[model samples]
Target chain A: MAEAVIEAKGLVKKYGELEAVRGIDLQVAPGEIFGFLGPNGAGKSTTISMLCTLLSPTAGTARVAGIDVVHDPARVRQKIGLVFQDPSLDDQLTGRENLEFHAFIYSVPAEVRRARIDQMLELLQLTDRASSQVRTYSGGMKRRLEIARGMLHEPQILFLDEPTLGLDPQTRRNIWTHLNDLRSRTGITIFMTTHYMDEAEYCDRIAIIDRGQIVALGTPDQLKAMVGGDVVTMTSTQLDAAAEEIEKSFRVTPTRVDGTLRMEVPDGKKFVPRLVRELTVPVDTISLRRPSLDDVFLKLTGRAIRDEEAGDRDRMRQMASRWMGRRR
Target chain B: MSVETATKPMAADLTIPVDTRAASLRAIYIIWYRDILRYWRDRWRLVASLAQPLLFLIVFGSGLSSSLGSGTLFGARGGLSYIQFMYPGIIGMSILFTAIFGAMSIVWDREFGFLKEVLVAPIDRWAVAVGKALGGTTQAMIQGLILLVLAPFVGVKLSVLTVLAIIPLAAVLAFGLASFGVMLASMMKSLQGFQVVMNFLMMPMFFLSGALFPLTGLPGWMTVLTRLDPASYGIDPLRRVVLSDSGLSSAVVDRLGLTINGHVLPIPLEVGVMLAFGVVLLGIAVVMFQRRD
Candidate 1:
């Protein structure tokens, strides 16, 4: 097995009385793509902040790239590269200038820095627009430039906090391609977080965090398997009656949420037809699909990952982005 | 995707040793260089910075000079012009504004998330604090120098010796103000908060610094406020040196210069007080930045 590049033992972070991250214990092997999959306000960002040595853990301990994050944060910072969820590029500077400044501050050797800057620009396919100020770049280009800057120093472990958040699907795919290319070429350990379930499918392993705690951890398939089998979701005006009828007729347990009845079956496609025909109560809608990260979250937490209760997290994300915007 | 085989050679690549002191110095240099580069790129800022100080020198000075007449204004000679006395004060105001606003870049950086970029780097946080302080100081001093070019027009005599003397004096004032600005900005969470606080603090400090008038004839309570103001110490020595070669009579010069309890504060001691303020504030800024980050 590869050595763990990042390891934590019950790490916790508190902002006064609010516990943002609570007892998150995990490990990432060197050169693996590790994803902290969670919805907003699930403590994903707070965990990344602690591991990246930006915020000290209020309790417990963490080691990134073999250095204790608290005992020696500088060493951890040296070994890790962080691509913030919020864009950290100086909009006033050109793409090349931004990379050059990062190179200098990271103390990359002068001779090596010049070559690395060119190499990064080319690798990220940003050579053509490298001379333009960052404010002129499109959102995708700006994100690519930020990633390029983060990788310029060749850090052993890279922490990306929702690298593709708020991006369109096409742009998100482009960023993923770039990230995959970089990972293939450098073999650096990539640690990232995202609320998007499909994005987590690309990770070698994932930890599902919610409400400041890790509820599940495994490869995507393993997590899905934990949900037992395929999922059938049905909605009816009388969800309780529909659920009771489906359970009694199909010999499968069903959970009622809102006006919907959800159940895991051996084969959702095979079972959905029977469920609709045999249900005594009229069904408004019925759908069947493979168990996903969302299903895994539902099974574990008894609530949809992106439930309406996420208003606080949405507000917090907005505040953070607005604060970041106001600085410029 | 077990990557152990792919990671073996990476161990060799990651171990490139670095000299800690040299790396720390390099970080400071890069931060300082980045600041100067940004300032250079913003031509409008440089131009706009001159407007307020010049307005004070031309509009305010001219308006007050006509009203007060050519008699002693601050204790200078009977012939010493109001424009001349206000020249050093105007320069002092320029330095104060430039330095304080220059440090405001921190608040901007924080809001923009650029502060996180710098803070997350491996270098010492103190290096960042000191580099920023020096960057603001250098820019502020340059603004003062630009204002100095108008010295002859204002009837303040200038020679090579006096010009050379003004450099250190202006630098002391700039550094002190820059450090104070950084200290205040370090504790600020938002640019709006910083602006509100600056608006509250700046006018009083500039007014109490005795920049527009002499410190000698202020009321008892105002005298204490002036003495407590660090800019007061900075402005007094700057006025004394810049006007010493203005050909003012000794009696009028004595009358116009800064005095406390019937004793004139020596130039070196005043410079020392400003230096102390600069160092102490800079130390505080470093502490605040380190703690916050």
Candidate 2:
């Protein structure tokens, strides 16, 4: 297992009375694309920050690249690269200048500094725009520049917080291609956090965190398999009547989420036809598909991935913690 | 997609043979250099910073100098124009304002998240603090030099040697205020919060530093304050350099200078106070930064 590039046990971070990360234990093998998937304020970033040495855990220890984070954080910083959740580029500087500044600060060797930056710039497809100020960059380009800066130091592990966050889907896919290419070429371990459920498919393994604890952890297929079958979804104007009639006839209750009745059937394709012939109420729409990570999140967490009301409450809590001088 | 992984044992790249001391020094220089690049990039900011000092030197200095009617305030020298006396004050004010506001970059970084990137760097926190102080000092010193260009127009002249001495002295003053600003800004979270705190601390420090008036013959409490103010020591040295060319007797220069128990404070001594205060304040700032995580 390549000595576990990152290992955490019972890691917890607290802000006064509120705990951002309760007790987490995980590890990633060398060259693994491990994802921490959780909604906002679900302790994804706090756990990442602890591993990156930006924040110390209240209880427990994490070791990155064989160095204990708490005991010798500076050495850990030397071995890891981080892309902040927020855009951290000095947008005022040209892309090449930004990379050079990072190279110097990270103490990249003078002889090879220019070459390493040039290589990263090319790897990210930012070579032609290298002399342009980051402010002139498109969102995806800026993110790519950040990724290049993160890798210029040639660290063993790279931690990206929400790598595709706030990017258009097309751009997000573009970043994914770049990341996969980076891993195949250098075999650098990638530890990233993202709330996008579909995005978890790109990871080799994922840990689903919620309310400061890991609810589930596994590869995407393994976690989806936990839901047991294909998912069937139906939306109707009269949800109450449709839910009653379907349960009465089929004896299989469908869960209600966002005004849609969802049921997991052994054979969703066959079941959808029977339901169409037998259901009493008129349905607006009905669909059958394989279980997604969102269904997995729903099954484990009892709420959909894009749980807006809960998200707002979590956002308020995060803001309060930040006001108290803690970063989530 | 299959990774086909070796994790490519980055052995050649990993062992760069680090000299931690050299790395720390380079980190400091890069951080300082980054600030210099940003300063020049914002042309409006560069021009805007000097505007207030110019307004004070031309409009406020002219207005006050005429109202006081030249040397009426300085009974001893009898030839010191209000503009000449206030010239160094305006320079101190410029440095003070620029240094304090320049520290806002630290707060901006915090609010915008760039600070976290720098904080997580392998370098020591004190290096970052020192780099920031140097950056702020350089910006303030540049503005102070621009204010110096206004001296000739105000009818005050500087010998080549006076300008030479004033250069480092001006930097020292800027360094002191910059350190003080870094100390204040390190503990603050938002730019608005920093602005409020700076205004509260900055206005009093500038006004009470005896920059606008002579420190001698002040009321007891104000005299105590001006003595305690670091800018008082900083500006008094610049005044001593400028007034040195006035060919005033040492008695008049001493009267114009800051006095404790009727002994005029010497340039080396005043400079020593400013230096010590800046270093201590900078130490506090570094400690604040270290504890921030």
TM-score between candidate 2 and the true structure: 0.91
Whole-model lDDT, model 1: 0.85
Residue B232 of candidate 1: its Cα lDDT?
Answer: 92
What TM-score goes with each of the models? 0.90, 0.91
Best by lDDT: 2
lDDT of 1 by residue, A97-144 (tens): 999989978988898998999999999999999998888999999999
For every prediction, compared with the true complex, DockQ reads: 0.43, 0.57
Give one digit per residue, the lDDT tens place, for model 2 in A277-297. 888899899998999999999
Fnat, model 1, is: 0.69
Q: Docking category for candidate 1?
A: acceptable
Residue range B125-147, candidate 1, lDDT tens digits: 88888888888898889998898
Off by over 4 Å in 2: A16-19, A235-251, A277-284, A307-322, A326-328, B1-17, B70-77, B246-249
Kindly give the stretch of ten consecutive residues in candidate 2 chain A with the minimal lDDT sum.
A319-328
Candidate 1 lDDT for residue B155: 85
